[model samples]
Target: MLLSCGQPLPLLRHTDVPPRVVENFILTGYRFPNYSLRECLLSAFRPTNETGNFWTHFLPFFIFLYYFVEVFGWEGAPHGDAQFFYPLWNYFIGVFCLLMASSMAHLLNSMSLVVREVCFFVDYGTISSYTVGSSLAYYYYIHPRAGTVETGGRNDSHMDLKPEHAGSLTSSYAILDFSVFFETFYIPSACVVAIICVLSCCNTRQRWRRHRYLIRTFVFLLPFLVSSTPIFYRLLTRSPYLSASSSFAASTSMSSFFYRHCLWLLMSAVFNISKFPERLAPGRFDIWGHSHQWFHCCTFLSILDELHMIKTEVRAILLSPTLLLPPAVLSRLPGPTVASTYGVMFLLQTTIISIIVWFSWHANSIHGPERDQLAKDHPKKPLKCH
Candidate 1:
């Protein structure tokens, strides 16, 4: 169902800046200043400014939903294999939550400032969740002893794994490994989340508004620092398993995984910052070819890219018994087939989106003072189209 392109959605601007094709615009905005939830969602079927942002995320959720249901939801991840399959399921949870949060944020962002702020909160949290989920895969696949199979023979499995592999490998899955790995990321990511929360509170404050997107990009990229630091450290320090060609390849695979994730993330940031085609040509780029759309697409692809990397590594660890370590939760996870994980994540997001919409609608009614006051403080010239 195609709607007319360049349909105007009432954009509540705080400045005299010209309007871009989409950020918060909806199809129904052409009909009325503020549309109902029915109109906002129905607009998803028709074209609008929010359409790209919405579909960029909207489509990914369905992919993730099917993956969780058909693959992780029904698959059996039995003994000694819990780490790989279960963590993957959880990672999908993070991916979809992120997609949903971002989708709703774009969809309702034009509805009201109050709604936008709430969506921003969910977006920030989802980012944190995705980071954690991505990193946990590292815990499973990038063990310190990854190169052991190459250093020694398959017979080496008879001996104690960590000790035998200690000289050639770093002997991962220790308490310290878990601590350093998670602490470095969790602390910084949480800080970013907290900062995002504060930024949301200052939503109407024009001082931070000028740099909001920049600040967000900065925080969004910060977690990469924590994640990348350790990967490089291991790649340099960990010995390569040169004897067996495959072992050497497997040993370095974790680095490849991180590289792919970083590459896509970098692309996402570029799309976000450049606003390229859209920036160069004003209204011409409105209906399509914007940075945010590229950003969303890049982000979606990145998740899949890393997921592939993690899957390969998990297979390596399981298929090669020499690579397996003693029982440790460093990479441990619940049963993948446990239907509850999917159910919980689905319910949690549904509840959150529902609550956000309800609150936003209510906020729209009473938020006149706040919105008007903010607008007064940062008034924009009336739209040329109007």
Candidate 2:
């Protein structure tokens, strides 16, 4: 049973392992594909069924990590406008952490039953981490709280300056009805939501296993919908003068960014739901260009698009950074801006990593139970390959 890593990999039939581990024909592959931790990392360098999945997000993770280091670890950071750079650093690190979490989930694919559960935990956790990253950028750079005269010391929505054609260098700013919401608006309690989501996805309950894909997708997107509710709502009630306003271009950019983000994100969901390209031509997609690959690709593109949007928003605010809050109010805006974001990202990532590690150490604990569950779920024997 203990095969040497140096030996040539064996071709595993669909029946070689539990049906749940490789549920569909596309998930089926040869033996020796499941290697030890050290070989698994090395296997990424060679071609395998999981190559595309592992590298798709893995490469993007490094790209984002480089940006994270450039923003915070470098000497120049913490030197200039600390206020601007600090929040930006927090945002970058949040993104980096989420990307890495996603990559690891993909990297550990087609692993043993116990290992797969740990990856499931990591994958589910990243859904929230990515949402937190997005919400961080939205809160800190996209739409911080600002008080207007009519609101009476209340600042929660994003305000756009309407540029009236007057013989003046400056135009008076008014709150746009299509106001963006604060980061803490619906995001403050996302941690609880995240915990729930992870549990729903990772639990070995029979009810959850019935409609697994739908359940996982809904749970994954729940956090995204919860955090992005403000943006979606603002778009619904957008204004006519929004284009001609000073923040028009930036607003347009942010809207475009959000659309792109949602588009790719939904594309990922579609690929997941439909199991496309592969479903059309079954065995052809076993190695690459499958739904999972497209999902990761779309996710990477969406994240990349947001990076540009973040830069545009930050630059726009730098022009009139103090317009929203006075000196007194500025001192108390840490929760939504940077501190809370940092805290949430760290908490989610650490807890998820801990769960993954624990599951791994006690892997044998779940093997028997999960295999038994799979046997009950699929009472018929696995079909023999022709």
Candidate achieving the largest TM-score: 2
TM-scores of the candidates are 0.65, 0.73
Candidate 2, 199-313: lDDT as tens digits: 6766532245767877777777877776665455446543222344444454557678778888988888887777788888877777778888898888888777777666655
Q: Across residues 162-269, which tens digit of lDDT does each residue of candidate 1 receive? A: 555544343432213444434334434533443444344334222465566666676656556654444554565543343344444554566676678779988888
Candidate that would win on lDDT: 2
Q: Model 1: runs farther than 4 Å from truth? A: 1-33, 64-86, 143-207, 239-253, 321-367, 370-386
In Å, residue 47's CA in model 2 sits off its true spot by 2.4
Give the local distance difference test score of model 2. Answer: 0.58
Candidate 2, clashing residue pairs?
12-31
* Cα RMSD, each candidate: 7.8, 7.1
